[model samples]
Structures are given as structure tokens and as C-alpha cells.
Target: MSGVVEGLEGRVFTVLGAAGFVGQRVVSRLRAAGAEVFAPARGDPALWTRPLGHVVYAAGLTADYLVRPFDTVEAHVGLLARVLKEAQWESLVYLSSTRLYDSLGAVDAHEALPLRLDPGQPRHLYDLSKALGESLCHTQGQGRARVARLACVYEGAQDADGFLPSLLRQVMAAGAQPGAPRPAIEVPSSPSFERDYVHVSDVVEGLVHLALRGQHTIYNLASGENTSNASLFDGLGRRWACELRATLPAGPSEAPRIRIDRMREEFGWRPKGLHSVLDAMKETCP
Candidate 1:
């Protein structure tokens, strides 16, 4: 396992969802590495006709999946199906979510773990769609596709959606108010809720590594450690000098500790912990 990611200089790459948060970073990183990158916008017909050298399929819904079930399926599977059928690519990397492991409680959430999902359940739509996408890439891609199941990804205190980013924004806003009484930031989740957060930069690196050099069909891109809400709130309360309040009762962690052994052994990739990212965000805060 080499710590060095193989040189991508002059390698042609196409990134779907290039306008998105993670997608944007992937494109930038690929270009910085001297890769010729093509970023086609959504609904661009050229995607079907272009010869995408190494494809990174980063388009998918998250928080809004419930309300946008049809779009979710389309983004996760429908478009991917077309790409697998129509587009020409030497290799492809599909960005899936580790949230698919939510039902596997207390177990090591690895890439080969058998997932239990019920299509009748509305919430499982996202999981099923992504699973189908993964399947299509595997069964139909002729071994040219790989899946990168991403964990909860965060990037400093930037304006983004998700548990960690929202919390960071709240704490930073409270800290910005000078002379105001320390406000009690109400946490919507239980203290026991935990997540394996991986930084966006690490995710971009892992995606590119998998896109170009991955040998496995699936890989978990995560920090391999869980961070509870209690730990996060305590750290934020101490760092920002704000009052911490939990709105929900303590319960079992919804997501298991994601395993990143494949990535580690294959590419020697290691992601920074959530607390460290928080601390760095604090340093840059006003």
C-alpha cells in the first residue's frame, strides 16, 4: 500500500454533478493534479455522446430524498443506467452513501456486508436507488466501475447542509455576537447519536484514487471512528463558550462505525477526525 496516490497527470476525466459541493472539489482536485477534466452540467445531452476517460458519478440527492423520491431514483439509478449503456468510459466511480448501512446496527459496516432493505418503506427509497446504481455499475459496467460509499462528509464551517456543518455554523454565529449572553444552542439529535465523519478533501482524494486505481468493486471512504453528538456539543460548547442543550433523549447510534480498511490497505489513505476539523475551523473563525 503506497501512501502516494498515483500520478494523474494528463489523464482524461469526466465528473458528473460538477456543480455540487463534493463534485466541485473533485473536479478542482483532478485538474490540479493535471488531469484533463470534463464537467457537464445537469441534463447536458453531451454526457451521452462524449468519450469520458475516467468517470466520477457524484450526482445524487441526500436530505431532500424523501420529498423528491422520483428525482432521487433518477439521479441514483436512471441516469447512471443511461451512462452505463450509452457513455464510453475506461473506468467509472460512483459516489454512494454510507447511510445505506443504517439498518446494520452495532456491526462493522464494511463494503461486502449484506444490506437489508425493504422497498415498501419510503425511507428506504434512497438506499434502494443507490443500491440499484451500485448493482448496475457492477453487473453492467463490465468491471470498469467501482463504488465509493462516502461517510458523513464535512468541510470546515462553510455554509453547507448536514449535521456537523449546521452545528458549526450555529456555534460560529453565537461566537460572533460580542457582548451578547452565551446562547443555549439546542441540538436536535440525541447525545448518543454518532457518525463516522470524513473530510471532503479526503473524500475527493479517495474518489480519485478509486476512479483511477481501485481494484475492489466497493470501498468505504470514511474516518473509521465514530463521533457522538455529546462529544461534539461538549467540544463546541467549550470552544465557543456557548450553552449546550440536547433536544432528544439519548439513544443508540443510528449509524455504525464505517470500516475503511480497504481504502487504507489499497491506497494508504487516512482521513482526519471530526474534532480536528472543528478545531481548525475555530482557528479561522472571526
Candidate 2:
């Protein structure tokens, strides 16, 4: 178990979307810290009726957001609006994504930078909805809400969606057979496609820190570094003795390096880098 967060013992916490990858981890961490956790199911009427002591709104769609646009909006904005309007909470931490910076094309992604979005683009649906959710939290939260712009979060070879996790899953599956020939892994994305990957546990810690002790309304929960797909595949190939291949041609990584000075200065937090975590996973992989 990870180190428990101080001052969390006996406190009440209500984690929305408790069944999700991130939400599940948040609930586990809170419980391990001796906190009271209420993980309500979707459409649970108690969400609006009961006094939600401290709320972590980890409910949001990813991976399938493009196909499930309506469901994405509801998860990102609809239910959130209801909670802010009706649910009573001492504090609320809304989980937003650093992917919001993808369209900016800037070198450094800071929390205060102005964002631009083209509504006509289909991909903007996810960004637009999440931005609106952040707006709602800021406008209606009555000063009790904080936003965490999380970067790409991964957990080794966990059977979840997302670039890094999916790639790791593929590698693990190919290497499952004992004494099998080295696996030839073909990556779906371009070699230069990159993201600011942060571990799921770090994200949970950052969310809890924001909900409990964050002084700023907005904070970026990221590793403050960008990892390219090429580098990732290279590390995997070396560690697993697998052949690496990329389906797409090499391209420039457009995503900017996310800034984490606020998180570091405020909470004294620093997350493990992608290769460090990957190396650790290699040791434990069967």
C-alpha cells in the first residue's frame, strides 16, 4: 500500500464514477488512508439528497468519447452541473484532462494559458465538454471546487483503454507464452506521437491532494515531460526482447510539455517518469 495521506482519517469522501479506472484507484487510496468512502452507482438519487462531505468527480469518458459523444457530455458536464447545484459537499475536485492542450500548439502547457477550440471539428466535442465542466465548477462551485488537469495516466499492463496501457497490454499478451519467439509489435500511432504520461497512483494522489489541501482553483497533475511513442517502443523492445514496428510514419509531437511547478511547489509532489515505471513493470511481468 502507498503511504496514507495525513489528516484523512475518518473524513467523509464521495467518489463519483467509482467504477472507473481512475475513480476505483481514488476510492482504494482513500479507504487505505482511513477515510469514509461512499461510491455511488450511476443515477443514484442519494447523490443529490445526501450530504457529500468531500466530492471527487472522477466520472468522465475517454477512448470511446469520439463514438459516444452524448454520453461523454453527460458524464463530463450534465451530472456535474446537477451535483454542483444540488449536492452538498465540503469540497469538490473535478477531474479534467491535460489533453485539452492538444489544440493549443504551444510549447509549454500551463494552467493559466487561454485555450482555443473549433466546435466544427468532431474531436472538439471531448475538449468542449470538459472545458464546460471546468467552467461550471468554477462558476457554480461557490469556491469549494478545484480542477485537476490530469495528463495521460497509465498503470502498467492493466486491461484498460488509453495509448500506453493498450500498448503495454499488447506486449504482455504476446510474451505470455513461455519460450516463444520474440514478439513483433506493431504500434498503431506514429513514432513521434507523444504524451505526458503520469501513473494512475500519482493521479489519485494528486486528486486527493487537490480535494483536501489545494489552495489554487486549477492545478496541472502531470510529470512535466513528454514521452514519444518511439522511445516507449524502444524501451519495451529492449526489455521484452520484442521486435518493434510502427504502422504510421514518423511525425512531430504536437503536444506540449505540461507544467507541474504549481503541483510541486504547492503539494511537494513528483511523479515517476514513463521509462522508470516501465522498467519496474518489466521486472514483475510474467
lDDT of 1 at 136: 95
Write candidate 2's Cα lDDT for 56-123 as tens digits: 99998898999999999999999999899988899999999887888887479889988888899999
Residue ranges of candidate 2 with Cα displaced over 4 Å: 1-4, 175-181
Clashing pairs for predicted structure model 1, backbone only: none
lDDT of 2 at 131: 95
Q: All models: lDDT?
A: 0.87, 0.87
Tens digits of per-residue lDDT for model 1 on 18-59? 988899999998888898999998888888787899999999
In order of appearance, the predictions have TM-scores of 0.95, 0.94
Tell me the RMSD of model 2 versus the true structure.
Answer: 2.1
Q: Looking at model 2, which ten-residue stretch has the lowest summed lDDT?
A: 1-10
- What's model 1's TM-score? 0.95
